[model samples]
Target: MERPELPLPQLHAFVVLAEELHFGHAATRLGIAQPPLSQQIRRLEDKVGYALFTREPGRIGLTPAGRELLPAARHALTDLADGLTAARQVGSGRAGRLRIGFAASVALTVLPGLLRTFRGRFPAVDLDIREMTTAPQLAALREGSIDIGLLREPPAHDTELGFETVLDEPFVAVLSASHPLATQRAVRVEQLANCPFVLLPRTVGPSLYDQITNLCIAAGFTPQVTQHAVEWQTVCALVETGLGVSLAPESIRRIRLKGVAFRRIEPNAARTRVAVAWRKSDSNPLVPRLRAAFDQDPPDGPRRRPNQ
Candidate 1:
């Protein structure tokens, strides 16, 4: 058996004829002359190798084949229309998937609120989020594995990417609730000189890692590196087990993780200047909308400079 290829125009004509059950009415519905409509129906019937409709002098009725094809034809037309709509939406960035990589600290910061706002404005943009440290995020961006990255500033020379700063947050001390400093209202950089420190690896987020150590060195002692983790929550988790103290952005306190107490650090100008990073040549239009979403006010407070 061979399948007859139905052209779209012919399919449309058949569907209209099936609904109207008369050549004149179907022609009127299609805004065409009855003679032309009749000619089109005859051509379709010839190709189909059977009469789709039994045409009497004044009335027309669908044959068994026409009835079966009516539903299939209607479904095919609907599918085609929907597919075209989807194509249009995707082309305009009104609907599509955006893969984004973020550091875990972002969970406690402005990223969530930024995402909510983006969704509110563009509900059709699907977000694919991955929690990665700054270093991995850089690699991901260069590899085109992610559309954007929410992370702190990279070193001056990692210039293969573009970036937009979302917020500048101050760093604070994060210690286990059971640790001695948990009772204190705040801790100083010098005070932590000799304590075992749980830190994010330098390979992951060099900026913050150097900031914590440099601040400690300036305060008079090098920290004893006791543990390292990439994700902020994991770093906090190790602290919960009383592994060591860690320096984190002030926004991290919002995580509300049990067994951890966050204290403001003194005399140290340490802070995490978080930014959204992407490939320099990346052309996904969704990226701009996302940046616009993040450009809004920081969720927790008034706008502050990097030092704030």
Candidate 2:
């Protein structure tokens, strides 16, 4: 047999009346009339199939069943209060999980500092960080796998998502330390026109890939891509072998391969940007709070290489 549902108001009334052992006093404490408090207790007793109190002329006392249920009832109310507090904390973005997707290369630049400061400010926010390329980050945001993304070359127009550029840096040429170009102060984008190029495949980062290719075209030549590597480290390694030259965000300078040299690209007109993106429809409270953190302490500005 299924028991009838006991209302919270009734349970609360029972606990109060049990504590006071006086209907009038309990009613005073609960901010209710004596009659209503007595009625609430009677209803709760009926649901539990046990008499919860004994009433005699000028006397009131709990029945054994009431004594047995008191501790459990009090514990239940305490747990409910605690649960509500935690829920409110999460609602306010003070405590909750925030899943963040970021590009692998971002780790070489502002990512570490951004995370350190954000953790200090919101220690209770559990950060779920995932390393992914731009396309996967966008896909994750759309499907709700991630709450936010720090990626490069965000789409110029997207109605479903909001993007804010956090870092914009000029392109630098990656050359073999022994290559003749490495001896020059800077290399013109067109100078690399005849050099075999090392680049990441277009499928991995289509927006950035297009940006680089278009920069080359604007310089009056399309690069002859001779090798493909997914990561900047690999691209630098390939460049070190003198297999080809490459163009990368200035931040890639952090990956110091002994055989690889970074040179400022001439014209300096082509640049790549890192942007933070989130779905506009997302209702996560932490989203805006994290956004505020980014705004307050934007990623460390990219370091410039010394004059050659």
Candidate 3:
């Protein structure tokens, strides 16, 4: 037998009648008269070539066909309603998922607090987060894999990406407790020239590594780089073992390594800034909510600039 085409309005009428099990209440719920509601159901049954409901003198009950069709009818109506609601939300700039990428270092500081606040305010919005380095995050944002990025510094890639400062933090020197300079009130970049250093790999971000190295040169000598670690924690861990000293942003203190002691790097030579970045051409309605996550007031004083 050929399958009959099911019209949406008739399907809607069938769903209501199935739930009510009576013509009068179903008509009340549908805002129509009982006779018209019955007429619509008869037309639906004729189209399907089967009696959906068995009507007795004072009672009505679903036939086998009605029972079988009930679930599909409910599902179709529900899916249609959900699709309409989603479309309306997008049209009004109120719904949809937003993918955000972040560097591991930034995740330790402003990202957590900002996420807590955003989750509370926009509970309906779906958020997807990806952990990535600054370079990869920039690439993902440009390629549309991500909508926003919490990056250490603004990318030097292209003018199509927009950056907004979220946090400005100064780099601090981390050394083992047994290191001689650990007891100093505050150490300058020049003072650490002779100490062995655990540096970030040149491949991680060459320009950033150069910025750290150049700061040492400005203090009058090249650093004695003993080892290179890819991530900040790895470098700091090596420092904790008394292998060498390292320069890291203040956010690294949150790690709380047992043997590590953090102190201000005098002259603020290696201070770094973090920002929320996104594509310049993106016009997604959720942009404002994502931006609100990091839109706190700037702290008073001279803010730190990026290495570049």
Best by TM-score: 2
| Clashes found in each candidate (C-alpha, N, C closer than 3 A) | 0, 0, 0
lDDT of 3 by residue, 139-256 (tens): 8888999998888757565677888766777888888988988898689888887899998876665656777788888889998898988778888899999899988878888888
The Cα error of candidate 3 at residue 171, in Å, is 1.6
List where candidate 1 sits over 4 angstroms from the true fold. Answer: 155-160, 177-184, 257-259, 295-297, 301-308
| Highest-lDDT candidate | 2
The root-mean-square deviation over C-alpha atoms between each candidate and the true structure, in angstroms, is 3.3, 4.5, 3.7
- Residues 89-190, model 2: lDDT tens digits: 999999899999998788886688788888999998899999988998999999999999988888888888898877778999999999888999999988
Candidate 2, residue 254: Cα displacement in angstroms equals 1.5
In terms of lDDT, model 2 sits at 0.88
Selected candidate, larger TM-score, 2 vs 3: 2
lDDT of each candidate versus the true structure: 0.83, 0.88, 0.81
Which residue pairs clash within candidate 3? none
- The TM-score that candidate 1 achieves is 0.85
